[model samples]
Target: MAETSPIAIICGGGPFPFSVADAALRTGRKVHLMPIEGWADRDRVAAYPHDWVPVGQYGRMVRVARNAGARDIVFIGTLVRPSLKDIRLDWKTIKILPRIYRAFRGGDDHLLRNIGKIFEDDGFRMLGAHEVAPEILAPAGDAGRVRPSAQDIVDAKLGLAVLDAMGPFDVGQAVVVTDNVVLAVEAAEGTDRMLQRIAALRRDGRIKVSAGRGVLVKAAKPTQDRRFDLPSIGPTTIANVKEAGLAGIAVRAGEVIVAEFTAVTEAADTANLFVTGLAPSSPP
Candidate 1:
C-alpha cells in the first residue's frame, strides 16, 4: 500500500513558498506545487510536480490539488490584489465572484479567510508557512552583533502600536522608527517601498539623521489570519534594511516567518544588523 503525500503547496509571491517546498521535501513528503500564474515563478515551480493556474481560477486550483494526491495543503507567499476587471474567471469561479468582491470591499483578512474557506469547502486544509516550516520562524533573540538600543526598543514598541491600530483596516504590518519618530509606515506599497521611502527622505534631508538609527518593526495585524498571511522576512529584507541604513529589525515572536533562516541570520551578522523576534507590546 502506498501512503499519500501529506501536503501540496499553493505557491504565490516571494521566496517563502519555495522554502516551504524545501522544508516539506526535507520531511520526506513529495511536495507538489500549484503555482498561480503572474504570482509564482514558473521555472522554479516547474521543478516540482505542478499545475499552473491563473490567480482567479479558484475552481481549477482545488481540482489540481486533489488530483495531485495532497491530503493537506500549505499556502505560502504573497498574492497581489488585481483589479477585478483583469480577472478572466471561469464559470465555477464566476459564481463565487460576489463573495470575493464583498470580501475585498471589507479588508485583507476577510478576503483571505474567504479564500481559505473556498479551499476548505473543497476538502483541502490550508496550512500556514509557519506550520509548513516551523524551523524557519525567526528565533527570539538578536541574530547579529548589533543590538537595538534603548531608544530603538521604545521606537519598536511605538511602531508595533501603530501597526496594531492600522491592522484591522488591512492596511500594513510594518513601520520604521528612529529617534523616537516614525520615519515611515507601510502602506499599499509594502515593506520594501516603505523602507525606500525612509532612504529617500534621508537622501533628500527630510529626515535629519545623517547615518542610521532606523528600527523596522514587523508584526501580525490585530486581526491577522495567521494560517495564511503571517508576516515574513528573509535575507532580502536584511539587505534592504542595510541599504536603508536601518540598524535593526523586530518582529512578532512565534508569529513571523523567516524564510531562508540561516542565510538571513548570516547576512544580518555580516552586516552587523540585528533581527529579533519579540512578543508584541501594549500601546503605551
Candidate 2:
C-alpha cells in the first residue's frame, strides 16, 4: 500500500490505538479511527476522523472503512473476549454466525486469525500495530536507568521458557517468576490482572520472595499471528510491576509493543524498576 493512502484503525481500549494513529499520521497517511463502542475512550477517538463501532457490526465496519478510502486496517489496544450474547449482531455477522462460533471454539489466537481472515476475504489488508508504528516496538537492552541483576536474568529466561512451552496451547503471553518459581501465568484475566494476582499473593504472604526479586516476562506466542494481538506494555505496566514487587519487566525485543515509550521509561526509572527488551537468543 502507498504510504499516502488512508489507513483504518479498529481501536479497542487504552492508549495504543491513538499511538498507532499518531505514528501513521507522522508517516503522511490519513487515518480513520473506528473505535469499539464499549472499549475505546470517547475523548481520544473524538480527536480523529472517527466512527464509533460496536463489537459485532462487521458489515458497518467494512462499509465505513471503505467509505473512508482505507484499504489497510490495524487493530490495537485491550479488548476482553466477548460472549456471543454480548455481540449485537447485524445481518453481516448473523450470516457468518457459524464461522464465528467455530472461531470461538478455539483460543484467542485462533479467534483473531479467523476474524482477520473474514476481513481479508472482504479485500481489506490486516496489519499489525507494530507494522504501522515501528517506533513503538521495544528495543534491546534496558529502557531505563536500572538494569536487571544476574539472578533477574535467570528468572526472566525461565519465564520465557514457560511462555514458549505454553505457546502451542495458546495459553497466554506473560508469566511471573521469582527465584525460579513460577508465580503466575496470564490467562483470560490478562497481564495486568495477572500482576495484580501476584501483588495480592505478596500481600497475603503466599509469595515469600522479597520485593524487587522477581521478573515479569511478556512475549508473543510461538505460533502467534503477528498481524494482531502482539503483546504490549506501557507506563501502566511499570506501575503494575512495581506493585507486584518485581525486580523488572522483560519482553521480546522488536516483538512486543512499547506504548508511550518515554512515559514508560520515566515510570520505570522513578519506580527503580528495570524494563529490558530481551533478544531472541536470551531465552532458552
Candidate 3:
C-alpha cells in the first residue's frame, strides 16, 4: 500500500534528503519533498516535486503533503534546533503553541519525538529514512580500502561505550577517542564543528597525540526514536575526521545512515582513513 502511495519527505540540510528520495523512487514510490527553507539545498530540491516550507508552518506542510496524496513522512538531513521566538508560527502551529513550548523544554530527541507525535495525531505515519531506503544504512566491516588497526578498534569500542553511557542524558551522538582517552564529545555544536574543535586543539599543541591516532565513533542514542535523527555519516564526515587527525571512523552497522556510500568510500580511501561499520555487539 505504501509503495503505491506517495511519501512526504521533510528535507533538511545536506545530501541525505535527496538520497532518500532517489532510493524511494527506485523502489517505485512517488515522493513529494517539503524542503525546510534556510536549511535544505534549494538547487537540489528543484530536481524533484517539492514545496518550500518555513520552519513553523506545520499547517502548510500538512496541506501540501495531503494535496500530493502522501500519507507517509520521512524527516532527513541536518537541522540545528531553532529558538521558539525565531519561528514564524502559522495558525496551526500557534494553536498548538502550548505543546510546542513544552517540546522545546527538552533535548533534541525529546523535541523531535514530540513534534512527530503532533503530526501522527493529525493523521500521518512517520518513517525513518532507513525504512524508505535500507541501502543507505551502514554495512558491517570495512567500508573502504584502509582498515582500522587493533588500537583504533579498541578506541572505537571505548567511544561507543561513552555514547551508550551518555544516551540517557540526550547528549550528542559522536565522540573522539585516542588510547582509551576521550578527546572530545559532540554537543550542541554538532559533529563537524566538534571535529574542527579537535583540529584546532591539535594545531595549538594541546593534543600531543600524533596525527592519525584517534577514531571518530558515532551511533544513535540507545532509546532514540529511529523514525527521526538516526546518526549519519557522509563524505564530508570523512573529510572532517581527516582534518581532526583521526585515523578512521566507526559507526554501528545497520543503525547509522551512510549518505552517498560510493563517495564516502572513495573519500575514505583517498584520505587513507579507515571507514568501518562496527557490529552492534562489537567493534569491526
The candidate that wins on lDDT is 3
lDDT of 1 at 10: 84
- Against the correct fold, how does model 2 do in TM-score? 0.98
Q: Estimate each model's TM-score.
A: 0.93, 0.98, 0.98
Looking at model 1, which ten-residue stretch has the lowest summed lDDT?
275-284
- Across 1-284, the per-residue lDDT of candidate 2 in tens digits comes to 65799999999999999999999999899999999999999988999999999999999999999999999999898999999999999999899989999999999999999999999999999999989998989998999999999998899889899999999999999999998899999999999999999999999999988898999999999899998899999888989999999999989898899989999999999999999989987745
C-alpha local distance difference test of each model: 0.81, 0.93, 0.94
Q: Judged by TM-score relative to the true structure, which candidate is superior, 1 or 3?
A: 3
Residues 234-267 of candidate 1 have per-residue lDDT tens digits of 8888888988898889887777888878888899
lDDT of 2: 0.93
Candidate 3 worst ten-residue window by lDDT: 275-284
TM-score pick, better of 1 and 2: 2
TM-score of 3: 0.98
Please state every model's RMSD to the true fold in angstroms. Answer: 2.3, 1.0, 1.2
Please tell me which model should have the higher lDDT, number 2 or number 3. 3
